[model samples]
Target: MTSIAAVTLEVADVAAAERFYSAAFGLGSQVRLRASEAATTGFRGFSLSLTVANPATVDSFAASALAAGATSLKPVTKSFWGYGGTVQAPDGTIWKLATSEKKDTGAATREIGEIVLLLGVDDVKASKKFYVEQGLTVGKSFGGKYVEFATAGPSPVKLALYKRPALAKDVGVPVDGSGSHRLVLTGTDAPFTDPDGFTWESASSLTPAP
Candidate 1:
């Protein structure tokens, strides 16, 4: 079994990224990497998603992220799937906050119930195959458009792949150009890139439990 133990972002200012994420999402400081400003350009090819227990929590978190300096990519609204919105963190990482359940009133907390790393891949089939070879078990999949993988243990973050254009459209972003996705997946044995150039890194500390 395999799990995306963590999703690390390469940012221009590690300290700034750490501050924003902690203030905006209550995430800890371990998920950031310091890199040159040139590291972020063009489409990142992926987005981070936060799943809460209800719609009120979704809106609360979205508003908090904006107040904490994130750019709103999409506003909170009711959709076929649920209520949610997209925001770009200070370091160029796009985040989606959503929940299927609806609640009329409640205060939003910095705490998140779950997080998923969504990859926008050029070829879903190829990317799926690559991860499968790396020992990740498939959870749910649709023809050439979306696929979900099972988490190996108590991993906080889940992983999924969707067609690039569809992903970009969902997040209200353009799908063009080549640059670092600013994403890194640790807990694997070696570093590698998928079909669309999303990189993954291996860290022994992140290895999943048996």
Candidate 2:
């Protein structure tokens, strides 16, 4: 089955982007997969991997992004809610940093909450059919325009189908092109919405499986 893989970006310098992210978020290091000799590395985390460009052996376009504006938004620091960092890339894109550790709730069971993913679609029925055939079971159907899907059993992943215009109205954003959004959920692939049409997915709050 086809799944969303990586969200790529273009950057100017690998080292500069690395330092920019590390200094801003206090992240660790990573080496390139194919280009061991080339100047490339990525960050960790499901949301990590700030790709930098190679001057001599440039591979992807992300290397070009470092030249945009890449500025520091929030310096590396910890907070009551969680550890945090923030940066604005050269392209004027904002990136936030938070503690990767799962918080302890001081209870016998794990807690559960909602984590939503927004996906772009040209036809809701077509997309829904595709996902259903892939073993993603439908939980609730919101008329012909919207459908909710769950993994299986007491699944952690929840999929919501939303029309592009409806979603834009809900968020109070003008129905323009889709910008960028992050859906932080465990045991699921990252879902990205298209420029205008989008998909909405959610995750149940973590809870004890019993």
Candidate 3:
């Protein structure tokens, strides 16, 4: 089965991006940085989701990200889904810190539970089918609206799909965007680009699995 080994982010400055990631979220090796001059604008068609234990942890991560030079897209707010917020990193990547739990289980900590790479696509069904063809197992599905893929990669980053417009709204961004996605997925499968133009390459081992 196909599994993502690393999430490589194409940035203008790899060193600066490295610093921001370390200082902001301390994501470890889940994210990789590569220098690129690819032209990109607007939403970039994806977001990195950071799931925490409670509202307090979400707040802490948000505060840390902002302090590390991430631009605030949406401040932390509670919703029916959970408590969360959106922030844009200095490297132009969007991050959503969220938690399904509404209440704080205990004192807030710097621990992060899961990381899901949410790719905004034009068609969920088509994309889902394409991924299945590539050997990714379907972990969850909700018709044409969303799909989550189960993975067995060494570096564990889960994968999920959502409509472009809907995903943009969830991340608090405008739908209009063009040019390079500025993102790449390194996985165990042979190199190929998905229907939405996300490139997946074969890698030995990496973080953020699916």
Candidate 4:
């Protein structure tokens, strides 16, 4: 199955954004940074989720992000599902660090299990259909509420869809926004835009701007 090969975040300062990412998440090449000044306000309509091993790991990441200059939108807390938190990076990207495991089983490491790209779409069913036509198979679907795409290949990022308002609530932000999402995904083959206006480009073309 096709997976998102990489995600590119367009930021105003490539140098600062790169440094922040290195210190905050150390995402390496799984995320690429590019230079862009596209006008954006309110919520950006998406979030990058980091799924870790346990609650301790979540706390560790949350601390690391704050120490690296990210503003905390939600403190690490335990919910019925698990423990998690939300932070907004200096570049204006919302990142959710979470784990389904409520307790720690071992020492906390910077080991990230999966990086999920959560796109907040206007229409879940429509966006799901658009991605399906783009050759992505559905791994999980929750009616028109949400959807997840399978990733059996080398792609590192898991893709999912959620209602925009719900996602914004999860991030503790308003759903209203304008201009670019400042995000770009490297999909399986050709480049195209989804029904929600998220762009997917060829992997070879996803390198950081020079």
- Once fitted onto the true fold, the runs of candidate 1 whose alpha carbons sit more than 4 angstroms away are 103-110, 205-210
Query: What lDDT score belongs to each candidate, Candidate 1 first?
Result: 0.79, 0.37, 0.88, 0.89
Better of 2 and 3 by lDDT: 3
Q: What are the C-alpha RMSDs, in order, of all predicted structures?
A: 3.0, 14.2, 2.5, 1.8
**How large an RMSD does model 1 have?**
3.0
Ranking by lDDT: 4, 3, 1, 2
TM-score of each: 0.90, 0.35, 0.94, 0.95
**Residue-level error in angstroms, candidate 1, position 153:** 1.7
**Model 4 spans > 4 angstroms off:** 204-210
- Name the runs in model 3 displaced over 4 angstroms: 204-210
Clash pairs, model 3 backbone: 155-209, 156-208, 156-209, 157-208, 157-209, 157-210
TM-score, model 3 to reference: 0.94
Per-residue CA lDDT of model 4 for 1-210, tens digit only, reads: 267877889999999988888888887788888899899998989999999998888988899899999999999999998999999999999999999998889878888999999999999999999888888899999999999999966777899999999999998888999899999888646778888889888866655433
Flag the better candidate by lDDT, 1 or 2. Answer: 1
Worst 10 residues of 1 by lDDT: 201-210
Q: Candidate 4's C-alpha lDDT?
A: 0.89
How far in Å is the alpha carbon of 158 misplaced in model 4? Answer: 0.7
Instruction: In angstroms, give how far residue 9 of model 1 lies from its true place.
Output: 0.4
Q: Indicate the worst ten consecutive residues by lDDT in candidate 3.
A: 201-210
Count residue pairs with overlapping backbones in model 2. Answer: 28
**What lDDT tens digits, residue by residue, belong to model 2 across residues 1-210?**
232211222344455655554443233322111101222222211122222112111111122223334454454343564433444454223443333333423331111122223343446677787676654677777665777666444432334566656544433334554223322222224343333323222223223311
